[model samples]
Target: MIRPNMERPTMKRREFLATTTALGALTLVTPGRLLAETPVAGGTLVWGHSETTQNLDMHQTGTASTSRVLQNIHNALVTVNSDMEVVPQLAESYEVSDDGLEYTFRLRAGVMFHDGSTLTSEDVKYSFERCADPETGATNFEVFNDVAGIETPDELTVIVRMTRPNAPFLARLAENGAGVVMPAGSGDIQGTTPVGAGPFRFIRREFGNEVVLERFDDYWDGPAHLERIIAREITEPTVRLTGLRTGELHMINDIPAERVAEVEGDASLQVLTWFPLNFDFLNFNHDLELFQDARVRRAFDLMIDKEMLLQGALWGQGETTASASFPNDAARNTDITQRGQDIAAARALLSEAGHPPGSLNVVFKVTTNYPYHVESAQIIAEWAREAGVNMTIEQLTWADWLSQVWVDRDFQMTMMNFFTIWEPDRLYFSLWHSTGGFNYRNINVPEIDALAEEARGTIDADARNALYRRIQDMVSEEALDVILWFRNGSIGARSEVAGLDTLVHPNGSNLNFHKVWLRS
Candidate 1:
């Protein structure tokens, strides 16, 4: 894991923010070993969800907000732990073939789904098939690229044979959408309501306001400590803080960085801070003739300073980076320098692309789902205008953005921010591959495709990491996308809330409230 050990920083907030997710020191002022005390159950915990969930169908949704809540209501075949290792969750145990092509998973015995159906190998097979089905419109269809066949040897055992050796195939299964298992026919009706054999089960979603979940005593892993959890949507920072302070909320995730000191100073409130494996990036649609020129794309990237944007848009809550990989990742090419803000250089690039500064006019579309996305886009738009580039900002609601910008690929340019399970294959293959499942930007290049295939099949850790580094270098040098920063998150909670490690205080920021409890 990239998470650093907590230490109070001696530097200023902005400078310290760059040192090991720099915000880790914020937790020091929190009292009473919060979330480390003996667990107790039977209380309702209302937390402020950063955004509204698109849907409960985990496989079909692309947003982290959806997975954040679905994780509490669903179980995966395997899961990532605090240490970032792949371990069994729904599957009691699993075995892999030495050839790195076949896997055998034994489902936990006597597990029951929310609808009282017993979990069997069939359920696992059904989930994978549904996710792989193009008709299902799942976000993780590419995850099954190596699958030759899925077989159920018995009621409890599922065997998967790959068409070719896939080194990270097992690890990919631990990701939210790919690994999540539901009942045989659950895929048919997972939109408004979903069912699974987990510590919590779906109760109801009050549209844009909130989604509710209740404890499941029949869960194979045992019941969640809280009797109920309400994920209330409140995007405004001030409103969320008010709810938290007024005792209307037990916890608030993604607290604005400016309020970290205040939350930490309150004796009744505690802060939970960590570096989330998430990023904000600018994407250019290759289908658009304007973005087809690499020089034009580079010029757009050069117009704005990533550091300035980080502080302006996020209050310096994250680390600046140019590649899809995190700033501190080993695979990042450190030798390549991220260009500073220079209007002269940017205008020169536009001239080289045959579109002089005044000649370049484009539309930049962004989503309102994340306030930072709109804020950062506006910041950069002003910079581009100063560079003699005529730019317009068009904001869309989350649902419209998903269809117009993501699925339809109908926009010239856009900025996106998201979090998910991180690995070489998950990061590179899903975004840069010619026909990647999530290649919404239409980044189709022969070299990137070749390197992605090679890296996906390469088994040795050191060899594959080198290949991934090459991919990162190519993506950045070609300006496939402008990755501005890797986000660090802070969660504010009442001191009475404990067992956070069991919630989102773990790998990939995957949420599982089953293990967390409210101190009585």
Candidate 2:
């Protein structure tokens, strides 16, 4: 469903404009009238950027946090609405051929890039082609793998021919990587400069300090309300909280789990929450010798207490999950709530797998920086010990965790979280596809992969949902990955801020910034 954070009520458009205008007139008539009378249009919003993003190239990085910043300064051919449906953005509209292999998009007329260059179908063709190239190192290349070729008949029309029918093709176009569209003759703008048709224009970036964006008055969607937005990098939760408390920051993200109560109690601060499609779970590396046995995987799954983890570790902020896919997804199987903490069942399964008590050496990998990861790892390790399984915990930083542990599959199992979207097709296909880059070599049943292909090719919603349900059940029964919990997405904003809608989607990028304005 379309779950948006509604805790902060929205003001009527007429009332908001009246208040802003009155305040603007009053402030402008003061001693510093020049600054105040300037339409209340220009003000910098200081936002916290939690992590250090190495690359600003949207195609190179599919992480949500990075995408959130990129979307303001870049534009996609199409945009995903709050309901997870595709809406026209750069392309005014599109039509699918009867066979569903060809898609023709009509580009909006008179759209200009931030650099004053007119947008053309050639740029669209070049951008998609570049993203599909293997040398680009784009994490989202697989999304467009179905495209056999792209053709631009004229300046305003672009046609894409797919090798196979892809039902989720339009949704994929709304992804973050899809927003990185550039001019045709830009000549490798990835590492150097980024030009796009977006509401905001990039001015300057100070690494580790802040990123400044100025309003694009010539934006195709009409001028944005805010004049400038400054996204600052503040990794520490306490520092971010302090900034919000002292009025130094307009907005902050990734609120500390412990401070949820305090933030909610404050009258001057507003806490926005949404049920995101993100799922945190334990991923087993089947390539590892110890994790190869299905029985062993099942035994490990039974050894952990998910409910207790949600209560004690996550502080009830997360919901228990049975299916590897998101619970809210139409594809999820609600019937199977697999293996709770049953030490006897776990021990028997271990015996059946020929792994005697204390014989199995299982290493749990987690990032040292994430508090929830540390808590969950400690609890699971203890539970596994109780079930007579020898377990050890290994912690690493974010960079080391991704490169050495995650990429290499160096550990027996690792605690990882996926920031999924509302659609199950994207989540299921990405995590379970045999050739999926992020699958991390954990394909157990080829049948499930075949089912995924079948679902992708099917256009009917009911048929596709049925295929997804079967895949979910098959994966859960086989114990491919131990489903843990679904965490809520949250954002903290000052009381003066209005129209702050946040959702649980990755990066909280689905926010509607167009209607937001400062309260008088």
Candidate 3:
């Protein structure tokens, strides 16, 4: 029932200029129909992606731009609900062994892929094998490391064996790309045009312009609310909002801080704001001799003025944060939040590092995909100059930034927001651990690796929280990464858009549109 949709509209430069914009997603809640106010389906949605997805391979793509769209086009053996709890999706039921080393999943019957094929345990085995293969290069490889082997006894039953007990193992299964299941031996097809058992199916892509998807009638959970979705690649925030305002687009994202008041006043637009699970931080290339010194790193960390950043870049829209860890456990102070909010400890630390004042000059690479990031970097550059550190801001397009800064690792320093993930291990183990699969910055501290590894194996909440607290202290004292603040995310849409209440995303970052319908 799935085929390349031929109805995609081609756009010229002037047409593109008028309709360009972006969309910001939010926390996952209940699956579709929870906000049932009586549904009216069947309409096209022109959703916005501030950046185009360079990697369509969900099994390996680390970027949110790719995974957001892929979320609608695929399903995994397990997924999360509105409570952010791991639940079954393609797998109707699952059980864990008492030893916590093996997981047995029973596949749901009649689950169909985009290519008109029924799902089987063999497909699950193939996908798991791909994650185990180092060649796949999945971002959250640490999560899959516990997976020792896969055993498929029958068409509907599959078992996953783990090397050790992992508390967050099931939760990680709800992550993007890493947990996605596709047809067996269709790895090549997934890298280009993916086929999965999602409520929607991929149609075509015009390379950095737009992606099209059609509703899957044979979906196991039933048909989706919307008939078609067009994810438009528009990098400019103003242009995106303009399209939303003019009714050329149904929804927009990444609303600029200055435009918040305007969107709130407009009766025709609906403003969605939430305190997202994310942090803005500066990433350093540890391979550089200058960053190898702990003192230099601390000096840069101390140079951050959180108040200035919140006001200047985010227009004081978010709360300031000094801690390196998420504030999930407040009772134990597991976050290890730096109570002494100081932005002027640089001079002494720089002196101790043996670097003469004004001897350091570095390029802070930032992505244009996120408007706030550029503003944040600009503000940071000003503070650096006061501390005798020369700073040059280097702006790169979203695709280029992903390749040069994230994939190629040719950048000296960069800044970005950590994507929304509920678990601390998902946040720290992949980025802070020395041998982490997604350790793009080349951070190689044996202590961080040891502490994070210790936390990963521990399932007890109290013990794990204690270990994470130590990791947080180490990250702050050593200045592993200069975390600036807790960011607030905003999403703007037209008044006519409905079913968004049903978009219970798994990782709190991707946009699932199965329940999102247009009001007729």
Most TM-score-accurate candidate: 1
How many backbone collisions does model 1 have? 2
Candidate 3 displacement at residue 367 in angstroms:
1.1
Best by lDDT: 1
Residue-wise lDDT of candidate 3 within 1-520, one digit each (tens)? 1211121111122232233222233432222333548778799999876778777878788877788788889998887665445678888888877667878889999899989889999998898788667888767666777788899999999988889876667767767666778899988878789898899999999888999999999999999989999989998988988888888888876777787877877766776665553578888899889889988887777787677777998887666666534333221243445423344568677877887678888899998888888988898888888888889999998888988988899887899877655566766787788877668889988888888888767766667767767776777777788767766666778877886655535344667888888876
Candidate 3 has an lDDT of 0.75
Estimate the TM-score of every prediction: 0.93, 0.85, 0.90
The CA root-mean-square deviation of candidate 3, after full C-alpha superposition on the true structure, stands at: 8.9
lDDT of 1 by residue, 35-121 (tens): 435678799999998777886798988888888888888888987655455778888888877676788888889999999999999
Question: Model 2: runs farther than 4 Å from truth?
Answer: 1-40, 185-187, 191-193, 203-210, 324-328, 502-515
For every candidate, C-alpha RMSD to the true structure in Å:
5.2, 8.0, 8.9
Model 3: weakest 10-residue lDDT segment is: 1-10
Cand. 2 TM to true fold: 0.85
The predicted structure with the larger TM-score, 2 or 3, is 3
Which lDDT tens digits does candidate 2 get at residues 165-202? 88877777776675457777563665445567788887
The lDDT of each candidate is: 0.79, 0.70, 0.75
